[model samples]
Target chain A: MNDETLSAVDVRDAVKRYGDFTALKTISLSIKDNEFFTLLGPSGCGKTTLLRMIAGFEDVTEGAIFLYGDEIENLPPHQRPVNTVFQNYALFPQMTILDNVAFGVEMRGNSKAEARRRAGEMLELVQLSQFSSRKPSQLSGGQQQRVALARALAPEPKVLLLDEPLSALDLKLRKAMQLELKHLQRETGITFIFVTHDQEEALTMSDRIAVMSAGELQQLGAPTDIYERPHNMFVADFIGETNLLEVSVDKIAQGRATCHLGGGHELTCNQVDDIGVGAKVHMSIRPERLFMSDIPAEAESLKGTVKENIFAGTDITTIVALAEGPDFIVRTSNSDRGNKRIFEPGTEMYVNMEMGAGRLLVD
Target chain B: MAGGAASGGSATTDTYKDARGWLLMPAWSVLLVLSLAPVFMMLVYSFLTKEFRGGVIWEFSLAAYDQFFFDRGLFGDDPPVIEWTYLTIFWRSIWQAGAATILSLLIGFPTAYYIATRPENVRPVWLFLITIPYWVNLLIRTVSMKFLLRDQGPLNDLLMSTGLISEPIHIINTNLAVQLGLFYSYLPFMVLPIYAAVERYNFALSEAAADLYANKWVTLRRVLLPAVKPGVVAGCILVFVPSLGAFLAPDLLGGAKNFMIGSLIEEQFKGNAGNWPFGAAASMVLLTMVLIILLICARQQSKAGKEV
Candidate 1:
């Protein structure tokens, strides 16, 4: 790797085991410099384990991790040029906001005056200059979180690890802070590796995301790539709302595969490699990608009875049941064009997916 | 009738507030009468003259206070010479108590840290074990030190048996023995408050410090120590005050040689000395010193509380 574009953090088959239980399996990924990388997963899915390992809080049971092209698996947390904004902020209750921000700078051997001046600048950057002399307990939760961020960033670390830093805030504050954090990351130009279980936050703020489940990496890519083209059943189910149908592949040609849906309905989908012909596969079509019509608009359209219709203000979800298959959900925006043709429960409808909208799962 | 009832209700509410206000009177009155009255009497007695009898005379005099500084000719024609005997005893008492406080803190902090770091399920058991020494009376505990520290006691016997010493060492009637007794008797007082502080502490703050590039020692100095300082101060005061006035340990362990301020006061009051006014003056001085120390500690604690 060139020095100019060397990855900020790289993990080579990193594994974490606690006694007999494995918290994270062999996971290998790299985070680019100046990128907003997110580890998105549910609780106990090894996302936090991976983040702690990168931060030197937990040792790797196997494999190695590198920071800025240097192996740091053996170094302690303090020796590493990395800092963390812990889930609870973990501000020092005894120190004022200015002192808290100056701590890291002082630890790095800066003079007291220099450290204090830098701390002042950081407090101003967080728009908390007036709170410089106030104790952390006196600040609100959002303010404390900003102080935590400023403190972690004051040292100008190579990478900043945030472990669910915004999870403690209310919904309104969380939404506001998410954008603020993204903006801060851009302004600092420092690599940020954030860990969170909220997919919406990840999609909105992350430049790239790694979806993890059961000690395994389900998928790693940009937000739109992971959401629009999930590699398997877990990724497709975890990222967003989707309709998965059990199907068998009939033939594979070029980048598309013809599959036989239930009730012998033959449909073609954009298939990923490694799926052989005549093998059982699950086809994923997002709810918003499926369109409802009164008559057959395409040659391979499938017909079903509308089992239920849900009105959710912005969109109307129509649940359809095939003659011999499970129920499928089709979401249509509540636009004026959509209101012209209303299909209530028990209405007969034909469903057709948009071109290139369906994907065949490899597993 | 409605207006009258409303007025009655207001009167009942006023009575409730008055009752709540006086709720503390019982405890306060007991403390004032039983504890403060004697201290107040001692303050008054310190200014009187010592009679030939065991009691004090009603005549106001500065003889006792003067005698605290001048051994002879306190008010005579000869120049009042300065004396170091009583001052030496006071100094010795202060230094011994300070040593005991430091030793207790050194021993107590690690023990408290150990208990604090124990698994939650087993922490209560450790705390209970630490408090077991308190169940035994302090006098008995202090007296038992003689069995271990005497010339032919178990400690010397063990040393002789190990061939580490040619003869049995005498430690029973020494200042070292007094300090050991004080340390042993008051260890739990030092440990409990520090334990409470450590137990209530959130260790994530230390981790945050470490994440900010601070090593273990730095983290302890900057984070852990400041966080637990209030408990350390409380423990120090608890140990120092009693250790300064410690009479039984020095009386039994040091025989007659140690002669701490506590023993000095005891000698003037009831021993062959029979100097009631002198003893009252010494007691008053000791009380004044302790009060000043307590005021300083309270002020520092309040300052710390405000910052935190």
Candidate 2:
């Protein structure tokens, strides 16, 4: 967040290809020192390829990658001052936990005693000091993952690249490790680059997130900014639960555009570029941003029939069907218990979004 | 009481559901009989006396074994003592067989590794090529090598034409020719096991070794070789044991002067010895040596398997 933090990595127009198929189109991004950055995308979105290229495991077909002002595109993985925690943890089954953690330092030509000492310190940092003598096969999945992290960290690399490090873990362990990893990064004050497809994990863990789709970066911003002020409908829908209501702009004057939604509901909002009057548009609204009324309320409110009520632990997810098209989901918190109780399936409800809550995009 | 009784009956029925359950004891007894028959026969024959009429006399005598240990001649009543002839043949057989096994390994290991590292689409084709030699008869293959390496064969013609030699080389009747013949016949026996071991290998382990900072040689020494050593040992056994017992390759490729233990046993049985008891005794000695080799091999395998 601070400009004073050194730029640790600067990827310039990186392009990767495998034969005729292009895995990553030309893309550019920079990461600051000590920053926790994440590449969040679906499978085959080239996120892992991007991470591998940065880790020096993969060579870029085009473009250059600079580490702290030194071009390292041609360097092999071992020569780079970076280490990767592979997706499968990639722990050496033949080695004990202590030996696995000491591997990188040993590769760097350090004495066995020195590497072990530094590796033991890292294992202690990851709270795995007592597991030094045990082989990887003897440890639990979560413990092996910690050793993987400790192994990557033992070399004191300039950047620690993790390729879905916790993806192999069960739900409960993954959640716990997520917090521990953040704390570890904070304590160590080292740059961490994490890759994950889980949007929730990205939103919770990343200081800055790069959302990629179909081999191109769709959006890059801080977690809150990427979620709240997404550049397009794709980013908006992909980041979280959203209701995209098709609309048309009537007029755009100054910074505001008056739009008409389904069932003739008219609204006025700030105009985004490329959206014209009489042209098709969609207004994106987060579920919590929309309020539900038990009965018909006002002219600005739209009417829908409640189809299903899903009771999540703290919130109720109510799926509503409009007379026009696809159903919309509205999430109401437990504090609004009385209103949800009054609204049930087959009951008519009024949906209204606050003016500033929705993002207007031209389709 | 009814529920518990019903459950107990069902459990008993489940245990005896298959036909194998009924025949298990008989099958095990048959296997036991078949495996121990040779050792029993050998023990009995070892104690029998050899009569002048070439028949075994079951009168409890260790005289044949004593004569074998001390006698030097191939046959006759007043043979020379000190078994130098049999010892020389045994020593030569081992040296030749050992040479064959090591040479086969040197050629087989790299070929197997190369086949294993090939991409998925090409692996089957290479494996097929390695096995194609077996479709041709083994005797034909051995005899074909004779034609290829004889004094006037194409090999000597090429050497003479190239001026590398002034005359055709006499390689057909030597120990080196016998070893070469043994190696050519059994190299595939060494390859297939090591290939299977290398094929089942996970390339990910090699990558992990590299990531751990092991160079190519260290990775090969510490990780790759140990992973495939069992296969190597198994291949050596497959090549060595058969080569030691081989008579066809040596008979076809070398002169009668080059005799192995197998040829000696053949000579006593069907050649001038005309004594079946002495031939059986010689076979019994070969069998003892084979048992020792097999025991050492099995012990090594178990020790290696336990270390992991």
Candidate 3:
């Protein structure tokens, strides 16, 4: 075999600085071969900067990067084996679609005929074979995006960097392109490092995601690992919707802690590190995890008054006002809402939750 | 879009209301008086017979075109020979204008790119500096160039002082001086349009080019140049058309050694020849040439309308 391990892209303590303002802090991660990895964050979170560094557009200020298990920290963009699909789909306007797609291969010293043939195959792979002769200006936004993808893939790069390629499309088009991109990744088996701010897009396509914020990696895990068990408030709030309630630890034993909610409801939850008895901590709960009941079926249920009920097509959200804490939101599917009636305003009800629905965060 | 119709006016016609047609009358009348009437008069005068002095006779004649195309003996009885004099003058003018255009492009393209790449606030200062010399009259600038380029001027003095040359290089009253004057006169025309095009260029395309394995030079040749070609063509036309008909540069810097089209036409009307018909014919030919260049440029630009 091979002398190298499974890493397709390895970033080691990368740092990027412009004068004194650091755009990316020390970030290290190893992307597995053929894995659809994502760098997800809000705008200005240094996610695109990291992707640029991988594609060799931006120099690494302090650390090293390896591509396909070979060191490429000093390689220029043209010499590197990684290619990027730009956010705006920067297709050459003067060239036909086939020529635009063939450009990279021709630049790599391939014959014009060979590059053209390879480009034709790539266009067919993207289902744009009929548009090969048309200029990029003649194509629509979604079509140009596919052309950009085809152009980047024509080089047969070991690692493909996509910088928010689907953001320019309408919602329906974005959704369709998402599925197409996933299928493309599977068909090519190329290591895809996608950068996006859309968490839903990341969760839907990425095999694993690295969540970044303010130049630091907050968490890196699979979608369910991140959404079910967030390490901090930022990741929990960013990845998906969650309600954080402040609770004080009453007792701790056997890796479990007894906590008192702000409304004087006592509950026991799985313990988290760095918490002492009587210490205030944050508890996160997803809205879909909670249910409404007229009669208390469990002693741990919290009693509350119905504040407002909101209907949002597929799901109905019921807001519950506690005696001394923030309002609790309970979500149920409309089908479930048919089985369970929405309590009218000012009616007292018990809010029940299943086990592991509430997670204790250190911060 | 529907708001305009809801406002109770005829929105189907657009913002140019029917009543506003009267507002365009002053501009149209001025154009007809200043442009159309002069061109019409020139066309009529070009076909009429030339008088002894500067006036044109009402009788039509082919004498002006024949005089331009054929040369006669001193006694006016020899068989007509093809006259290459005016054609040579016109050819030289075209050559000089083409050289000046190329020279300005060589200098202005880099200057424009430099200014366009600067920080947003600092760019205006550089553009202002470029326009500062232009604000002064063109004649004054040409005269100043003559002063600076003369044999005993500061340029030769500085070169001699630096030990680069033992003897002062003679640049005054030569074709080189006229070319330099023309380049200086219209460099701004080249710089401004290219600056606008470069400013509007998407830098992401450059990055994408690099990602697609293009080095800096290849990216510029294949992508950047093609994207900004319309601006380059506009700059060329702006410089070349004006340079073709320019009289001041050749007169002031070229020392009147050879006849250019402008000077030949000037001689017919104002110099010793005083032939109004020949002057009008030369003017019509030059006007037609410039119009053809402009029409070709417009058709090519509209054929593509810009890539993106």
Best by TM-score: 3
Per-residue lDDT value at A2 in model 3: 51
Q: State the lDDT of candidate 2 residue by residue for B154-187, as single tens digits.
A: 8899999999999999899898889999999899
Please write out the lDDT profile of model 1 over residues A238-354, one tens digit for every residue. Answer: 888999989999888888899988788878887677788998989899998888789986745788998888899998888999887778888888884444355878888888778
> At residue A219, what lDDT does model 3 achieve?
91
Q: Which ranges in model 3 have alpha carbons more than 4 Å from their true place? A: A1-6, A334-344, B1-21, B51-53, B73-79, B162-166, B271-273, B302-308
Error of 2 at A185 (Å): 2.3
Greater TM-score among 1 and 3 belongs to 3
lDDT by residue (A222-269, candidate 3, tens digit) is: 999889988888888898788788899999899888888876887777
Clashes of each: 0, 0, 0
TM-score order, best first, reads: 3, 1, 2
Q: What TM-score does each prediction get for chain A alone?
A: 0.96, 0.94, 0.96
Q: Which ten residues in a row have the lowest lDDT in candidate 1 chain B?
A: B266-275
Report the Cα lDDT for residue A138, model 3: 89
Q: Per-candidate RMSD vs. true structure?
A: 3.5, 4.3, 3.4
Better of 2 and 3 by DockQ: 3
Better of 1 and 3 by DockQ: 1
Per-residue lDDT tens digits for candidate 3, residues B1-308, read 68866775656456677657888999999999999999999999999999977888999987887777778733367777888888888888898899999999999999999999999999999999999998899989999999999899999999999999999999987778878989999999999999999999998888888888899999999999988998899899999998888888888888877456887787788845599999899988899989998998888888866433
Per-residue alpha-carbon lDDT of model 1 for B169-286, expressed as tens digits?
8888887888888888798889999999999999889889989999999999999999898889989999999999988888999887787999888878885457888999999889
Where model 1 places Cα greater than 4 Å from the true spot, the runs are: A1-5, A248-255, A258-267, A277-281, A307-313, A321-324, A335-342, B1-15, B21-26, B37-83, B150-172, B268-277, B305-308
